[model samples]
Target: MSIEVSNESGMDVSEEDLISVARFAIARMNVHPAAELSMVLVDLDTMADLHVRWMDLPGPTDVMSFPMDELEPGGRPDSPMPGPAMLGDIVLCPAFAATQAKKAGHSLAHELALLTVHGVLHLLGFDHAEPDEEKEMFELQNSLLAEWLELRRQARREAQLAERDRRLLGKAGFFDA
Candidate 1:
C-alpha cells in the first residue's frame, strides 16, 4: 500500500511508527495492496479550522477523516476483485491528542497509534454515530490496535535476542571480524 505521512505539527513525532501502524491497519482491513493513503499531522490551529469548517465543531479534535472513495473490505471470495484506490486523508492534531493521552494514562505514541487505526476505520466507512455502530467500531478499533501493538512487542523481543546472539558469537570468536 502507498501510505504517505507528512508532519506539519511543528512537534517532533515518529513518522515511521505512524506509517507502520497505518499499513498494518489497512492490511488488516483487507484493503487492496495498491490502495493509497495520506496522513497529515497538523497544528492545533489548523485542526481547529478543519473541525469548524467540515464538522462545524468549536475546537480542535484528535483526528478527522476525509474519505475519498467508497471502499469495503476486499480479498473475500464473495467480494469484488481488489484493485487500486485512493483511500482518503487522515488529519491528526498531536497537540490535541497529547491532552487525551494524558487522560488515558498512556504515551503519546500509543494514543496516536489508536487514532490512526480509528481514522482508517472511518475511511473504510465505519462510524460511531449510533450505539450499535459505536460498539462495533470501537471493538474493532481496539482489537486492531491491541494486535498491532503485540506484534510490535514481539518484533522488539526478537531483535533483542538476535543482537544478544550476535554479541555472544563475537565474544566467542565464532564470527569473523
Candidate 2:
C-alpha cells in the first residue's frame, strides 16, 4: 500500500508513525497492495475551511475522510482479484486532536492513531450516521487500532531485546574494534 502522510499542522506530530499506522490499518482491512492513501495534517484554519466546504459544519473537526474510488476490503473467495485503487484522503487537525486527547485522557499519538484508523474505515465505506452503523464501525475501528498498537509494542520489545543482545556480544569481545 502507498500511504503518504504530509504534515502541515505546524505541531509536533509524528508523521512517520502516523504513516505506519495508516499502512497497518490498510493491511489489516485487506486493502489492495497497490491501493494509495493520503493523510494530511492541517491547521485549524484549513480544517475549518474544509469542514465548511465539505461537511457544512461551523467549526474545525478532528478528522475528515474524502474517499476517491470507494475501495472496499477484498478477502472473499468469490470476489475478484483486488486491484489498485486510490483509497482517498484523510484530513486531520492536530490542534483539535490535542484538545480531544486531553479530554480522552490519552496522548496525542494515541488519538491520532485512532483517528487514522477511523478515517481509513470511512474511506472503505464505513460510517456512524446510524446507531447500528455507528456501533459496528466504532467496534471495528477500536479493534483495528488496538491490534496495531499491540503489534507496535511487540516490535519495540523485539528491537530492545536485539539491541541488548548486540551490546552483550560486544562486551564479551564478539566483534572487532
Candidate 3:
C-alpha cells in the first residue's frame, strides 16, 4: 500500500516507525497492495478541534479516520483494479496518545501503534456500538494486533541474535567490529 504520512505534531516520533505501523495495520485488513492510506500526525489542539467539528466528541481522541469509497454495510469489498484506491486519512494526536499511554502504562509509541491499527479498522468499516458488534470487532482487532506484535517480537529477537553473532565474530578477529 502507498502510505503518505505527514507530521504536524512537532513530536519526536520516528517517521519510519510510524510508516511501519501504518503499513502493518493496513496490510492486516487484507487491502490491495495498490491501495493507499494517508496519515496526519497532529497535536492535541488540532485533533480536539477535529473531534468537536467532525465527530462532535468533546476531547481529543488518539486517532480518527475519514474513509473514502466506503463499501455498503455487510458487503465485502473487491480489490481495486490494479491501481491506487484511496483508503482514507487517519489523524492521530501524539499529545493525547502520550497522556493515554501514561494512564495505560505503555509507551507512547505502542499507544500510537495501537491507535493506527484501530483507525485503519475504522476505515474498513468496523464499529462497536452494540454489544455483539463490540464483542466481534474488539476480538478481531485484539487478535490481529497480538499476532502482529508477536511477529515483530520474533523479528527483533532474530535481529538481536544476528547482531550478537556479528559481534562475536568481530571479537574473534574474523571481521570488522
The root-mean-square deviation over C-alpha atoms between each candidate and the true structure, in angstroms, is 1.9, 2.0, 2.8
Using alpha carbons, what is the TM-score of model 3?
A: 0.88
- Candidate 3 ranges beyond 4 A from true positions: 71-80
**lDDT of each residue in 1-177, candidate 1, tens digit only:** 899999999989999899999999999988889889999999999999999999999989999999998777863345465654689999999999999999999999999999999999999999999999999999999999999999999999999999999999999999886
Clashes of each: 0, 0, 0
Error of 2 at 140 (Å): 0.6
What are the per-residue Cα lDDT tens digits for candidate 2 across 1-177?
788888999999988889988998888888877888899999999999999999999989999999887465863345465655688999999999999999999999999999999999999899999999999999999999999999999999999999999999999999966
Q: Among these predicted structures, which one has the highest lDDT? A: 1
Candidate 1 residues lying further than 4 Å off, grouped into runs, are 75-81
Work out the TM-score per prediction. 0.95, 0.93, 0.88
- lDDT against the true structure, per candidate, is 0.93, 0.90, 0.81
lDDT of 3 at 169: 90
Error of 3 at 105 (Å): 0.9
Q: After superposition, how far is residue 129 of candidate 1 from its true place, in Å?
A: 0.5
- List the candidate numbers ranked by lDDT, top first: 1, 2, 3
Clashing pairs in 3: none
